[model samples]
Target chain A: MSLIEAPRTPTRGRRTGGINWEKWGWIYMRASGVVLVVLIFGHLLVNMFLGEGVKAIDFAFVGGKLSDPFWQVWDGLMLWLALIHGANGMRTIVNDYATNPKVRTVLLAGIAVSTIILIALGTLVITTFDPCPAGADPALLASFCEAL
Target chain B: MPEKSASNLVAEPQSPPKIRSPKRPAGTLYRGNEGMWSWVLHRITGVSIYFFLLVHILDTALVRVSPDAYNIVIDSYKTPLMGLAEIGLVAAIGFHAINGLRIILIDFWAFGAKHQRTLFWVVIGIWLVLLAGFIPRQLMHVFGG
Candidate 1:
């Protein structure tokens, strides 16, 4: 004979009747994980795997890329997506562990403020980057700039 | 039948009574569901971006150290493929930053359930507008303009 049986009334109460949020979190994790795999790997392949590999990396390498609009957009997308994905993931961890209401609120606020400041600064750098400034010392200028 | 002696009789062991532990109280506010998860992800991304910034700063500083080394680095950025990689980077930063703002508002519980979706879409709209302006500038520079 079976000992277990279903509840008679399904335990109707304030706690039992509410929204299910855990399901959505699980979904976001898997979704972000998939996208991250592509973005991260694609990033590595281009930076380290192509051409002369890691040795080819230098200041001009960055300047050359930043000079082009295509790279700027590419970098921009990666920046936004990865940052959001990472922040969201951390938020989940914080929610799970931070029990004290006041502490949790403070921590969350800190995260928000810092993320905003960084994103703004980073975007500015990418957009306003000047590879070869006119007044820059000749000694500091790249070979290409000297040619010009 | 002969009566059994006390020592000869076998005793049956009694089953232990089950003791149920008290259930923990469920968290308040949205019943601790999807919103909680979003909040968590927001923090994770925020930290990662911070570290990436550190590395980026060091790498760029090389330009000041040596022009030859800097040009070598800059040359790599010239490739078409590298251009695409950059797009990914921008998207990551933009999405994280905007969504992070949304999370901050949600924490205040000011918007309520009704306005959550509205706020989300508004953030998305802002991201799109910014991207539209940014992409063209990047392309023009890459193509040799």
Candidate 2:
């Protein structure tokens, strides 16, 4: 009779559960990174490169842009994407460095709270922004305000 | 060559035993399992945003410095092309914010791995809803409504 060696069993204390989370997170990073490259570069090119260049930026300029629906939508997208990306990125850092469970929890909570607050405030500013308010200090107000 | 005295044969008395150090198993800098890469990218983005914020604040402060200068800057924002630039900014902020929420949930709530797919879809849905509302409003402004 011939003897054969049996296959070795896996070591004890290995984590179990069917789902693979790390893989998915990695994929999310790459995918978001790709999209971010396009969005970020495009944003810089238009704001800094085009038109009269960097010197052309100002309140009336912003008011004028916001006055148009196109700019509003554009600004809105940038706000949403960058904020979420940043928040997600921080979450990753917290998970990696924060060893204590309680500490991790606190850190994560802080990130969430801050992100939500910023998003709410930013969106409000974009949607409710007034290019030309009534009865403002004439010197402080833009030309459009006076015209109104 | 003859048998040396016991004293001579004895190896020079070794230095008094120093405190023994504990053996430490090797630890990985990054977890080999899922999500490690994503976590790394998140940190990079967070730091980038901080830098961007400083610049943005300074630029906006220019308005307070000189209205004429501000108006010159503002006028540049008036073009149709500039409108598109704003779109890019909105997209960046939107994606970052929604993804950030996801990271928060996974870390704090102990959202199991199984639910990651669901959460991702939910984020996309929220983004779409916001975009829908924002786009039309922006277009109206551009068209001189």
Candidate 3:
């Protein structure tokens, strides 16, 4: 075993009943990774490179996309997948590096707590956002919202 | 010839005690079940998402600064290149979300692990279906206008 290896690095990780969570976790990483590549790239291409691209983004712009149920579902899925994927990856990192049991626990805890909070906030923003509020200063509102 | 002491000859090779187990012959690792494949994809997607997240949030935050500032940047997205890029993002999201569901099922559902391989295929099937639904509409939006 390497100096930092968990003293007993099971050739295979522990099991629960007949299940092996570690194996599953590993599998989850690869599967998610492959999918994320396409999702993330497509998202970037559309948002930053498509019509009007980055130059067209604004309160009106985002509001327009969010207004559509299609974009809503798309953004929501992206949020959940990215957050969980990131959190799981961090957990794996913590497991690999934080040899001290207490340190590992704390880091893992932080990852979980932070990830959950971000997911909640992001989802809420995507779902509940309004491009123009009734009482907001007209100056701040996008001109497009005037049509609504 | 030098005097070969028993201790000198015997101790040197084994002193480090390199516990070498027989390594698996190459492709055996890759030939494993769905779990292994999933793990690999998850790690890769996890890393890719991290990079995308950084850029996405930075741009999204621009909205707080000023509408004009944000719109200027987003306006660039209308190009043909970006439209093509959108398709790629749909494919990625479709696969990741479906695969993620499989994982969630394995964790929470009683039958998840037992039928994990079947579930794996189901994930792919759903992903393709979603893509089929999503692509044409997205293409029209991107290219038609």
Candidate 4:
């Protein structure tokens, strides 16, 4: 008779019913990563490549884009997707390195809170941003804002 | 069959049990090779991009404060030093993005693991091409063409 070898590591018995969040998180990393690659590259191309690059960025340049519904939606998506992706990646890192339970939980909570706050703030900025605010210097405004 | 006595067993000179050198060299796949280096680079770039995202969000949030507030903050991004930093940022992003796709392929595609080394090289190739196109234009924009 052959002697049976024990498992090298401890593992849980298969259980049913609850949602597998860790699995989903893994999937999210890959799925969101694919989308982010395209979204961020497009963002960089438009914002950094087309004309003056970083030198061209300013309040007017940003306001011009935010005022456009297309860009608003694009930036909104990018913000939400990228923030969560980053937070989740950080969570994985914390789990790997922060051995203390208290420290790990605190770090994970920090990531979650910051991600939520940034997503909300970014979304608000995109949706509520006004290119032509009254009483502001017209020099800093987008060219179209002058007509408005 | 008679069992060998302990004294006879102890007295017999036994050749060292043939320790078969492993079929494959140790420390190549997961330790020192393309797979390992790619993974290390991926972690480094991922952490860097994450921290940058946090700062970027805060900076962009200044837009809500006022136009002047936002412009004042953003003006710093246009400096020559920042322009050089942007190159590093883009390089990190390019590697992360390309290597990320390679990771996905390794996870989902059957041939991916078999070709992971190849995929890593491919990632570097694509990343170089991207930087090639980006650096010159960025230099022109920053230094004034």
Best by TM-score: 4
Encode model 3's per-residue lDDT on B1-145: one tens digit a residue.
3457766776676556576666874445336667788767766655565555645655665554556666666655556687677566656655665777687678768799778888888987887877776666666666665
lDDT of 3 by residue, A89-119 (tens): 7788788889898998899998888777777
TM-score list, all predictions: 0.45, 0.47, 0.53, 0.88
After aligning candidate 3 to the native by TM-score, how far in Å is the CA of B138 from where it should be?
2.0
The prediction achieving the highest DockQ against the true structure is 4
Better of 2 and 4 by TM-score: 4
User: Which digits, one per residue and each the tens of the lDDT, describe model 1 over residues A72-138?
Assistant: 8877666665556555556666777897888888878876776666566667767777767666666
Best-fitting candidate, measured by lDDT? Answer: 4
Q: State the DockQ, from 0 to 1, for candidate 4.
A: 0.70
What does candidate 1's lDDT look like per residue over B57-112, in tens digits? 44554554455655656566657776665555565566666665565565556764
Return the TM-scores of chain A for each candidate in numbered order: 0.69, 0.70, 0.80, 0.89
Model 4 residue runs over 4 Å out of place are: A1-16, B1-25
Candidate 3 local Cα displacement, residue A105, angstroms: 14
* Residue B95's lDDT in candidate 3: 65
- Summing lDDT over every window of 10 consecutive residues in candidate 3 chain A, give the lowest-scoring window: A48-57
Docking class for candidate 3: incorrect
Score each candidate by Cα lDDT: 0.61, 0.61, 0.68, 0.89
What is the clash count of model 4?
0
**Ten contiguous residues with the weakest lDDT in model 2 chain A:** A5-14
- Superposition TM-score, candidate 1 onto the true structure: 0.45
Interface RMSD against the true structure, candidate 4: 0.9
